[model samples]
Target: MLKVVVTGPLAVGKTTFVSTVSEIKSRHTEERMTQAGALVDQLDGYRADGEAAKTHTTVGTDFGRLTLDERMVLYLFGSPGQQRFRVLWDDLVRGALGVLVLVDTSRLEAAFEVMDMVEAADVPYAVGVNRFPTSPVHSLGSVRAALDLSPGTPLISVDARDRDECLDALIAMTRHVLAPLESV
Candidate 1:
């Protein structure tokens, strides 16, 4: 089985993506949001269902498993997106085969630090643009330019709430991970 890390900035849909694609019962370490966290957690203009804002925050990690075919399986690990949880990223990303970094077009800058950590770990990664109702509709080129991603990196539009869209992003990451081996 390949271990794939699902990561991004706060409220970028890492948890939702994992839950949508995972075949097994997903495990989440989510905590109810309190007013005290409002200072650090930004929910403004971010809607979980296009109607209501998210009420919980991931405190530890979210886990799920997906079987792509008879021979391939993916163990998905979703890291907490808050900045305070960054210390755990190294451990979460350790030994990961690849990473799926979700981004909110409305808050593209929030992704830089997460991408930096993933790059520093030297793991192959793809970016998933999760467009919420309030998010600006930027072209893939614009998103790539804004994120400063390389030409070869996979960047795709993904609706984290949709299974098919999430699976497509995962498949893209899998192909990306296998490309180097295909040449060798």
Candidate 2:
């Protein structure tokens, strides 16, 4: 079995990505937003569910599983987006084979922290640009440059809500994770 992390900034669709790709039902530790959190969270560029504002947030990690073959299975962990929840990252990345960093075009820089966490975890990672309906067009080269990504790092566009796109992203990440093993 392989363990992978699906992580990104708030409302970037980590939950939707896991839900779309997992063969089995996903477990979520979500809670309704309360007035107490008003000062704790930011509401910038929030466009989930087409609601004027997002209400629910993941308090803990979201878990799901996907079967690649009879002998292969992928365990997916989706992370909470807020910086306050960063303490959970180290634990969540344990035994993870790789990380799939989802980037929101509108908020590309928001993914920096997630990428840093992946590096800290000492795992291979690929960046997937999660497309939103309102997202403006950005060239891949610009994205690569903006993120200061090495030329070899995999960067692909994906729709977190689309199964095929998620599958493609997963495939890319798997390849990246295994490349070192294959070369050795």
Q: What is the C-alpha lDDT of each candidate?
A: 0.92, 0.88
Please state every model's RMSD to the true fold in angstroms: 1.2, 1.3
> How many clashing residue pairs appear in each of the predictions shown?
0, 0
The CA root-mean-square deviation of candidate 2, after full C-alpha superposition on the true structure, stands at 1.3
* Candidate 2 local distance difference test against the native: 0.88
Question: For residues 87-138, could you state the per-residue lDDT of candidate 1 as single tens digits?
Answer: 8888999889999999998899999999999899999999999978778899
TM-score of 2: 0.94
lDDT of 2 at 92: 91
The model with the greatest lDDT is 1
Please report how far candidate 2 places residue 132 from its true position, in Å. Answer: 0.6
Candidate 1 error regions (>4 Å):
none
Q: In terms of TM-score, which candidate is strongest?
A: 1
Could you tell me which 10 consecutive residues in candidate 2 have the lowest summed lDDT? 43-52
lDDT, residue 88, model 2: 93
